[model samples]
Target: MVLDAYASSNPDQVHEDVLQKSRDACYKARDAFYSCLEKESGKKPTEIASVGLLYPKECSLSRTEFVKSCRSSWGPETRGGILEKPYTFSSSSSKFVLLISDVSGGDLFMLEFMHMMTKLRPFVHSFLKEASKMFVLYIYTMGDRPYSRQMAKLLDPKGEYFGERIISRDDGTVRHQKSLDVVLGQEKAVLILDDTENAWPSHKDNLIVIERYHFFASSCKQFDHRFQSLSLLKSDESEPDGALATVLKVLKQTHSLFFEDGGEDLSGRDVRSLLKQVRKEILKGCKVVFSRVFPTKSQAEDHPLWRVAEGLGATCATEVDESVTHVVAVDVGTEKVRWAIREKKFVVHRGWIDAASYLWKKQPEENFGLEQLKKQGTDEKSDDVNI
Candidate 1:
């Protein structure tokens, strides 16, 4: 929907005049509203933004009425199976959900993937409304090409609703932990999507590490799978479309458990049994991880359920130790953040140079203002340097 303020800031060159005409109507409404208001109200009625024009043209959102327009096609009344029912939101205490994945095959499928997500925006909204925490990450192993650029569009459409929830980067050493550390700072939900088959050196082993982190956090969820398409089927393709469809259905439908339910009450035995069943369902295929993040020391000490988590084949770690190697802190507000590596007893206070570069990659502006500083640091000799 177009608001009566700042709509002219962006207009398609092809339809500039048409959009301007529509915006003119909004301007008139804003003028009328301002005309009736008293100056003492301390508000100016200016032409606001057109939410419809904010979407990419290829998304077919020009005729969009409201943000809700995208979601009007969801729920049981529309079509599909039981999972097809409109999502029933549970109040989320989380501020974000982090989705980290190493998507294979470059960026070809990203647009279509985001289109499908935008289609599901309504359901996402339903989940967010009840969620206390909010944030979702779609991190790719492949670096700064189509994935990073397109993810920015999907996460922050129309240049609003920005937060710590959506972060993407390619630094192998710090990508997983750094992103998770930042997301957990606000105790938000996390959804890690690993589509790249060999994302890490020991991906299967890394999955174990990730599972431990999630289980300990008490505020994380994950979804990982290999990328495949059913539409690729040509006549006599002999690709077993039904089997592929069944697996996709199970992945999409059952993956909701990652977003909705916390899966908290399951004990080690229960988790093992459930895993066994899930394994049986896929004939020993598919790997799933469920975890919880505990934020406070007292919480961990009082409820050592995380200790039990390791028994279920998940690693459980507490990030409280000052001497706990592997802690990397990146804070935009801090002059210098702390960094610690494994077996390192000392915490190094690195200047914001590298950290700032990292942030710039994630938060690029019209003009990057830190180039001179990076050049200076590149010449300096320091162990703290990590740019």
Candidate 2:
């Protein structure tokens, strides 16, 4: 409210100063208001920030115009309407492609359909800065119009990244699923980053599946997860070496390949195929075989590890052959492990494949060796005995 007032008072400079200047002004206003309330109610200022409802009497008198204007502008009827439209950068010559998602970029937690708290994924701002350079960035989220606009304000306050290309739940097609049919660009050029794969079932080829970011307890609870939230743990995903970082590198490569390598014909290029090819090269030139990795009754090709290995561009086989490069096993005593050792092939735990899948890079074989697995098993057994 204070920041809004400051923006209204300095309409000419608000665009450039809202982030820093208005932030400072809001903090000062909050402090003064809370101090005044605390003196009247005999409560701590810290508690006032959280759940205090007392309005500062001085602010009511001093900021009467601002409050009156705000009330008139944001009355019950006007509040639900669209705040802003999608913006287009006239200087950008690149082919405009839309990015649609619900969870990949950020997650919003709602309390009783009234208050909302948003937690942006790590490196999101950096990702947007980089992505905006390559594609005409558009945000299509399932959140409501007001909430989406609020998130956009935090993400691209200067309005340089995502002009008016924001689409909210109110703009969605029937069944509440995101559809590229409404997007102005060609379907082949659009690339979507979303955590829920099924949400874009029709556009799976264009969709890049990302791991969901769960920061708050409410977010985890919404997904029916019982694990501790990142907020409660006081830790977040690594900013430098995190999911968004990896995704940005992929986007850069895709954009470069799309514009530079794909020749002058921009319409013929598709980022989805480029992304698939890039992912395939992560574990290329390797043959992986699993021993005792899956249950005896389970189909070798149907196993999760097999799918992960194949997805990473590694050929998965049931038997250790001369072409095999790595033997993934749980126990070092397995016959395939001995065979791999005899053939001088890399014998590693299943975690090596899993790590490569998650990191999108070939993990060091030394870090996932049978010795490490043996030590882990020993430690587990010792702990069990102690129990």
Candidate 3:
């Protein structure tokens, strides 16, 4: 249904008719296989314990051949090969950074897999162009071999960025976890960018978590989320100052720090530690207090805002003191708000902390003050009453 809708909207971009026919053929083949299993097991289709147990050898072969033929007719196969060597760089350059990045939900989101309609995440091409100058870029994805290669082609059409360094699920371990063992060269020198942290549990020190990109309805559905997609909204993240742009700056800083000391030994240097230090400095030297932000009777220490403030290097206190630099409040009539006004401290809304967390930078207080929030609340309430 999603594909149909996308195809209708983008008639020239997708081969919806061909995909629909192919889907019908697959359905018919599946139904035939199920019927054969039902007959062999001497039971109804729903009563069969395992379809593989009753599947006949001849029927299995026939079904496999049919599917293979369908795939061949649908699209060309993706090419695969071993990467021989890294791309040539200037001889004067001092360092070569190793980067392993994911594809789906990281660089782009698949809207129609059959027709191959994808929405690229914001700043993807710009980020790649900037990072490629400092790093030997590689593509790592949990998707199948053909799909990964196809996406790599789309992302690097000129073949200048990721040259044959594409690793898919077929090349990874049987346990479905990515390991540095498969990656050649020094493990400590390599940095990984991926949206899903659990995919690389063993290499957390080398992994930098990225915000997941959801640009299609099916992509969000796969993760059990129902938010509006970028395609549906007809908007994308800010290209000039988006998450990818911010991450590129961090990557550049990490690369610079790795080669800063002019030392021969680069084994001890880790980008993860640098990333932590950069994050810790975002809200450093600031003391914060919250009012009417947590549920009544709930521990303030256990609240998410408290943990976020601490994580961003802010000191959280229940009571306002002389050192209080900011007061996070949702209500304008709170005592803390009045105290912050009297003390001339920054009195901001709950979104001030959230925006900093998402943008990885401190947002201006004037943009998220109590007056703006009150006006927003009034407008929403008026709309609700009218509805």
RMSD, every candidate, angstroms: 21.3, 15.6, 15.9
List the candidates' TM-scores in order.
Answer: 0.26, 0.63, 0.62
The residue-by-residue lDDT of candidate 3 on 112-169, one tens digit each, is: 2333345456677888888887777788878776666767766776878887667677
Compared with the true structure, what per-residue lDDT tens digits does model 2 show for residues 233-330? 76778878887787777777776776665344454556778878887898899999877777666688997678878877998888767999998876
Estimate the lDDT of model 2: 0.65
- Least accurate stretch of 10 residues (summed lDDT) in model 1? 210-219
Error of 2 at 215 (Å): 3.0
Could you give me the TM-score of model 1 versus the true structure? 0.26
Full-model lDDT, candidate 3? 0.65
In candidate 3 the C-alpha lDDT for residue 244 amounts to 83
Off by over 4 Å in 1: 1-135, 145-147, 154-191, 201-277, 284-387
Per-residue error for 18 in candidate 1, Å, reads 43
How would you encode candidate 1's per-residue C-alpha lDDT over 1-387 as one tens digit per residue? 354334644546536766888999978975664553313122232321112212222334322232244345434322111111132212232222334443221111113232211111112322222222333333443444344545544434443333322334532335433333322211112333343323444323212122111111111223321112222221111122322222233233333433335543211112223322332332122111111223323444344333333333333244434423222222212222222223332222122212222121111211222243344343222222221
In terms of lDDT, the poorest run of 10 residues in model 3 is: 378-387
- Winner of 1 and 3 under lDDT: 3
